[model samples]
Structures are given as C-alpha cells and as structure tokens.
Target: MRDLLKISARYGLIGSALIIIMFLVFYFSDENPLQELQMFDLFIIPIFVFFGVKEFRDRYNGELLKYWEGMTTGTIIALLIAGITALFLYLFVGWIDTSLLPEHIEILLGNLEETRDKIVEEMGADSYIESYEKVKGTTLRDIVIDSFAKKIIIGFLITSVVAVVLKRKELKPKS
Candidate 1:
C-alpha cells in the first residue's frame, strides 16, 4: 500500500504539472482553457494511468500486479491531476481574471443559439430554456465541479481497462 501511494503520488504530481502547463499555454494563446482541459483529458488521463500502473507493477511490485492495485493507482493519479487543475482554474478565474467566467458563459450561450433548433427538436423548448438559464447561472463552483467530475469519470473508465490488462498473478511453483 505504501508503495502504491508513493508511486501514485509521484506520477500524479508529474501529470498535474503537465496539465497545468498545458492550461497556461492555452490561456496565453487566447484559446479556451476549459475546452482544452476537456480535450486533453482524452489523451493525458489514459497515458498517465498506464504509466503509473506499469511503474508500480514493474518497479515496486516485483513485476506482479493485482487488478485493484492498477485501478487504485490510476484513479489516484487522475484525481490528483483533476484536483490540482481545478484549483488552479478556480484561483485564476476567481482572483486573476474575473471576466473568464462571463466569457465562458457567453461562448456557451452562443453555442446554444447555434444549436437552438436542433436542441428544441430533439428535446424541447423548455429544455433549451433550462439549459440557457443553467449556463447563465453557472458559478465558479459549478465549473470546477463539472470539470472534476468529468476527469474522475474518464479516469475510472480508463483505469478499469488498464487494470484488466495489467493484472498479473504470481505463478505457483510445483508442489
């Protein structure tokens, strides 16, 4: 367990740093950081999870891995990355740039308008109205929660597959 956590924390911090750097790059480049976070998760989450579990199995666990160990390692790394990224976003939007939230809301509104007809047809006018209102009312807490939720969920799914693939039992010796 100690080895698991130690390895997980190491990989988690590394992953978090990379994600923060990516966020800063997007912010400085005038791209949407929120969108970038979502896009990057599709790639980064799987990679860190894989490497973290592999490291534990190879370096710490004598080339043996349990399904749960892999899952836990991947999950911890994902959680750490998500948590640190969310905190950075919160501080940035809350303190540094107060306009980011409004800008995001505006972008969401614009997208809703663009898809208004399709949304109404597929869901309903009420649904569109509700969504519009939700976007307008979105808070920093909401954004952070949403982002964290997405990351953790994606992480768990990737971890599940990784754990299955990486799990190894010790071979029994002849009696």
Candidate 2:
C-alpha cells in the first residue's frame, strides 16, 4: 500500500502540474478556459495513470499487476489531479480574476441561446428554460464542483479500461 501511494503521488503531482500549466497557457493566451480544448484532459489522465500503474507493476511487483491495484493507483492519481486543478480553478476564478466567472457564464448562456431551438425540440421548453437558468446562475463553487466531478468521472472510466488491459496474475512455476 505504501508503494502504491508513493508511486501514485509522484505521478499525480506531475500530471497535476501539467494540467495547471495548460490552464495557465489558455488563460494567458486570452482563450476561453472552458473551451472545447479542455478535452485534452481526457488524454492526459489516461497517459499518466497508465505509466504510473506500469511503473508499480514493473518496478515493485515483479512485472505482475492486479486489476484492483491498477484501479486504486489510477484513482489516487485522479483524485490528486482533480483536487489540485479544482482548487486552482477556484482560486483563479474566485480571487485572482473575479471577472472570469461572469464572462464564462455569459459565454455559456450565449451558446445556449444559439442552440435554443435544438434544445427545446429535444427536451421540451421546460428543459430549455431550466438549462438557461442553470447557466445563468452558475457560480464559482458550481464551476469548481463541475470541473472536479468531470475529472473524477472521466478518470474512473479510463482507469477501468486501463486496469482491464494491464491486469495480470503471477504465473506458477512447475512443481
């Protein structure tokens, strides 16, 4: 267990740092921080988790990995990355540049309006109004929670597939 956490922490910090750097780059470049480019996280989490689990199996576990071990390692890394990124987002939007929250909300609302017809047709007028209100009332706390939740959910799904692909059992030697 100690080895699990140690390796996970090391890789987790690296992943988190990379994500934070990406956010900074987006922010400084005047690009919308909540843009579709954020999807890059889908790739980042899996890569780091894969390497982290692989390291544990190769360096510490005699080249054998269990599904649960891989899952646990990936989960821990995900938690660290998600928690740190969410905190950074909270600070950046809540304190660093308060204007960003409102700007993001406006952008979301504008996009929502652009797709009003489609949303209404698919979900009905009530659903469309609910979505509009939800976007309009979004807060920094909501953003942080949303970001954290998304990372965790995506991380778990990716970890599931990774664990399956990497899981191995110890082979028995001839008696």
Candidate 3:
C-alpha cells in the first residue's frame, strides 16, 4: 500500500510536469485550448498505459491479477494526474487570465445551447429547450466535475483492455 501510494504520487507529479510543459508551449504559441488539451490528452495515454503495465508486471504473476493490478494502477494514476492537472490549470488561469473562466463558461453554454436548439428544432419539442434553459448559470466546478468523471470512466475503460494485452505470463501446455 505504501509503495502504491508512493508510485501514485510520483506519477501525479510527473503528470503535473507534463501538463505544465504542454500548456506552457500552447499558451506561448497562442494555440486554441481544444487543440492543445486534445493533443496533449492523445499523447499521454500510451505513456500512462506503459507505466501502468510495467507497474503491474513488477508485482504480479497470474494474468488475472496482472490485469486487475494494471487497470487499478492506471485508473488511480489517471485520476491523480487529472486532479493535479486541474489544480495547475486553475492556478495558471487565475494568475494569467481571470477571464478564462467566463470565456470557457460562455463557450460551453453556447455549444450546449446550440446543440439543444438543433435537437429541439429537429424533434419539434419545447421541453428540451426549456430543460437546457433551466440551468441559467453553469459553474466551473460543475464543468470540472463532469470532465473528471468522464476522464475516470474513459481511463478505466481504455486501461482495462490494455491491461489484458500487456499482462506478462507464461502458459504451460496441457499434458
């Protein structure tokens, strides 16, 4: 448990560093948030999964145990990394651009409103539009929670399959 905690913290720290580097480069170069975060996310998965597999292989023998260990480790690491990344972004945005929150909120609401409006138009339903309008103010906390929850689900889903493939074991022939 101690070792697992240590490993988890270490990965979080490493992930924080990666986030800083990626975001800094993006910010300095005036990259769009979607382009930067999306690209960064795409790049991080393989690296995280590699570490996940290596950690599990170091501790376990059976394939099932290896799979569980890898998936668990990956999921925990992903969550820690996400929390750390969010903290970094929160701090950076607070420091560099306080307007970021409003900008993002506006963008989100606009996108959601547009999508819901289109759906309502297609179905000729007033209820769907009314439902979206009920939430007049969307907070950053809500966005973060939704994003984090999605990341947790996605991380577990992807890692579970990778864990099976990356399991290290030898099979004996039937006699």
Model 2, span 14-131: residue lDDT tens: 9999988888888899976766436978889889988999999889888889999999999999999899989998898888888888888888899999999999999999999999
Question: If ranked by lDDT, best first, what sequence of candidates would result?
Answer: 1, 2, 3
Best candidate, lDDT: 1
lDDT of 3 at 37: 71
TM-score of each model, in listed order: 0.95, 0.94, 0.70
Candidate 1 local lDDT, 48-123, one digit each (tens): 9999999999999999999989989999999998898889888988999888888888999999999999999999
Give residue 59's error in model 1 in angstroms: 1.3
Among all windows of 10 consecutive residues in model 1, the one with the lowest summed lDDT is 31-40
| Tens-digit per-residue lDDT, 1-175, candidate 3 | 5555566556656865786688778777875352347456656755775575566456533333356667766777778767776666666666676665666666656776778767777775777665556444655565456546655665677678777777665666989
State the C-alpha lDDT per candidate.
0.90, 0.88, 0.63
Total clashing pairs in model 1: 0
